[model samples]
Structure formats: C-alpha cells, structure tokens
Target: MNIQELLVTGTRLLKEKEIPTPRLDSEVLLANRLSKDRVYFLSHGDERVLPEVERSFLQDIQRRSRLEPVAYITGKKEFMGLELEVDPHVLIPRPDTEILVEAAMDMLKEKTGFVHVLDIGTGSGAIAISLTRYLPQVKVTAVDIDPHALKTAKKNADKMGVADRIQFVWSDCFQNVEGIFDAIVSNPPYIDREEMKGLDANVVEFEPVKALYGGEDGLDFYREIARQAPGHLKKGGSSSLRSGVPRPRRSEGSWKKSVLDP
Candidate 1:
C-alpha cells in the first residue's frame, strides 16, 4: 500500500482499537518503519510502501493497539529536546516533568562555580542530562533504586554526550548519595494505590509499576525524599519536585511540606 493508504488504514485500525492519538501514532510508527521522519509522511504520502516494510509497520501498530506506549515501540522519547532511550525498566519522562527542570534552571541562574544537583530516583536521567546540557559547569549525581534503571539512565547520558558530567549512583532515594548539592530534583512516583486502577491502559499495563505507585496516600516517595534530603543538601539548597499536583497548589502546599522537613 502507498503511504497515504497505509496511514489511513493504520489510523482507522488504531481508532477502532480505542487507541488515543491514533493519527499521530500511525504517522509516527509508519515514518519510523520507513526509516524516515514524520515530515516524510506529509511530503511523500502518496509513495508506495514496500510489502516487507508494510508488515513491519503493521506489527508496531499491533503493539500500540495492545496499549504499549509508542515510546516503548519506538525505543526513544524526546525529553527537554534530547532524545532519551527508554525501555520497560524505566519510566518514560513526561512533559510535566519539564517544569521541575526549568525551575531548577531558574534557581541556579545566579549561582556559579562547582554547582551540583542530586536527582533522586533518576530514571532515564532526563533531568540530570538536560541540566548538564544547559549548564556546562554543573555536576549532577543521579540516584536510582533500580540497577536496571540506572543502566538505562547511563545509556541516555552517554547518548546525550553528558556521561562525563553525570555520576550514576545506585541508591534507594538518598541512602547511598554523597555530598551536598546546590539543588535536588525528583519526579518520583506519586500515584495513589487506588488510583492505579483508573490509569489508562497505556500506563497501568505497560509502564513500570514501581515508578507509578506511591503507596496508599501517594506520598511515600515525597515523604522519604524529604526525610532524607536535608543531610545531602547544602544549607539553603532547593528542591524541585515534579508530580501530579497542579503547579500553583504544589508550590504553596505539598512541595513546601516535602522540602521544609528536609
């Protein structure tokens, strides 16, 4: 089938399967299968897809229909303008998390010389890598509870050319972390236990559970991070946390609770 026909059929099939973002998913998957960018779809929609290429594209769509994240199928997610490699072992970084990254950037604007950040529960190292990308003099020590997740983060750091600036630590929150930091950033799991059942299948079924659930109240990671961060942070150091909370309410309430105690 030709490019236009293939995208049309794929979009229809995904829509029928109740996949959200069907058209976008179809376009991305088809473009990836053809070893082209999404622009290729718009520019060459009428070009014929090879029989073998079509088969591969269809298989990717089937995985998406089964509720697997498109990022998992594509094996890459663009975060903070950097493409990060992701797998089932680590949580895919989201756009909401970018808020915390920007907050940290703003906090560090006036600081200089040997700045450090401690990224607790650093999954794919998106925050740490992005920070190093923007701040040439900053050092980031990224900690993760899961060794596999640390491996994934290191891979991403290398891919983004920030491997030298990031120190990957295997720790449960702050357990093994060392030194004080100018800032601490985290996007820890904050989904409540009961709320897990209500998440869309793309997340509940495919994303890592350890990276999604945060105990019955959804405050476990926040509590733990706040409890331990004080010892690892420099005096007056800041904490930038990203979660499900709305930005304003979080800055006024939950975030204050999580950081003050530390």
Candidate 2:
C-alpha cells in the first residue's frame, strides 16, 4: 500500500484498540520504519511502501496498539533537543523533566568557577548530559543502581559528546558516590505502590519498574536523597528532586532550595 493508505490502515488498527494519539503514533511508526521524516508522507502520498517495510510497520502498529511506548518501539527519545537512545532498561525521558534541567542550569550558572554536580539515578543520562551540553562550567557525576541503565546513560553521553564531562557511577543513591558538589539533581523513581497499580499499560508494562516505584508513600527516594545530600552538597548548594511529590522533608545542613515537579 502507499504511504497514505498504510497510515490510514495503521491508524484504524490503533483506534480499534482505543489508543490515544492514533494518527500521530501511526505516522511516527511509519516514518521510523521508512527512516524518513513524517513530512515525507505529505508530499509522497502516492509513493508505495515496500512489502517488507509495510509488514514491519504493521508489527510496530500492533505493538503500539498493545500500549508499547513509541520511544521503546523506535529505540530513541528526544529530550531537551537531544535524541537519546532508550530501552526497557532505563526510564524514558519525558518533557516535564526539561523544567528540572532548566532549573539546574540556572542554579549552576549562578555559581562562580568550575562547578561539580551530582545526578542521582541518571537514567538515559538525560539530566546529566543535558547539563553538560548546555552549561560549559559544570561537570557531573551521574550514578545509578542499575549497571544496565548506567551503560545506556554512558552511550548517550558519548553520543552527545559529553562523555568526558560525565562520570557514570554504579551507585544506589549516594551509597557509593563520593565528594561534595555545587548542586545535585535527580528524577528518581517516585511512583508509589498504589500509583504503580493504576498506571497505564504503556508505563506499568513497558517501562522499568525500578525506575517508577518509590515505596509506600512515593517518598522513599526523596528520603534517601535528603538524608544523603547534605554530605554530598557544598555549603549553600542546591538539590532539585523531580518527582510527583512536593519538596521532601528537610535534612539538616546547608540547603538553598528543592525544585520539585508538581
């Protein structure tokens, strides 16, 4: 079938499954399968898709209908203008996290001299790599408990040409992280047990659980970060926690502010 016909068929299949954004999803999947931009379809509607390509596109449509994320299907997610690799091993980067990154950039820019930052659970290196990419004065130590996630983050850092500036550590929270920093940032797993149960299949089934669950109150990682941040942050330094919860209970020591994602 032609591009237009194939997209219509794909969209119908997704719509039958009650998937939101069916048309956009169909277009994205087809564009990825063809290694062409979606805009290509607008002008080349009559162009026929190869039989092999059509079959693969149909498979992707089936997966999306099953609630698989487009990012996981395409193996890439664009965050902060950077197209980063993603898989089931790491949490997919979302648009909301860009606010946290911007907050970090502002905080780092205010500090004088070379600044060191710490990124807890730097899945896909979205936060850490973004900071290094935009803020030249900062170097980041990004740690994660999952080595697989770390590997993925490392590859992203290398791809973004920020590998030299980011030190990927295999540490759960701050257990293995050393030294203090001018700032600390994290988009930790903050979905509570109950919340996890209600999540859409796109997340609950496809995304990594360790990257989503946050104990009973959805504040376990916040507690851990608060408890450990004082030891790892410089005097008057800041830490931003991007989670569903508001600010965490303050741990004693020097803290400027906590930027929480509402």
The top-ranked prediction according to TM-score is 1
Write one digit per residue (lDDT tens) for candidate 2, span 43-99.
999999999999999999999989999999999999999999999999999888999
TM-score of model 1 vs. true structure: 0.94
Q: What lDDT is reached at residue 204 by model 1? A: 86
Candidate 1 weakest ten by summed lDDT? 246-255
Deviation (Å) of 26 in candidate 2: 0.5
**What is the TM-score of candidate 2?**
0.93
Q: Against the true structure, what is each candidate's TM-score?
A: 0.94, 0.93
Any runs in candidate 2 off by more than 4 Å, and if so which?
A: 245-262
Quote the RMSD, in angstroms, for model 2: 3.7
Clashing pairs in 1: none
Global local distance difference test of model 1: 0.87
Query: Local distance difference test, per candidate?
Result: 0.87, 0.88
Off by over 4 Å in 1: 246-262
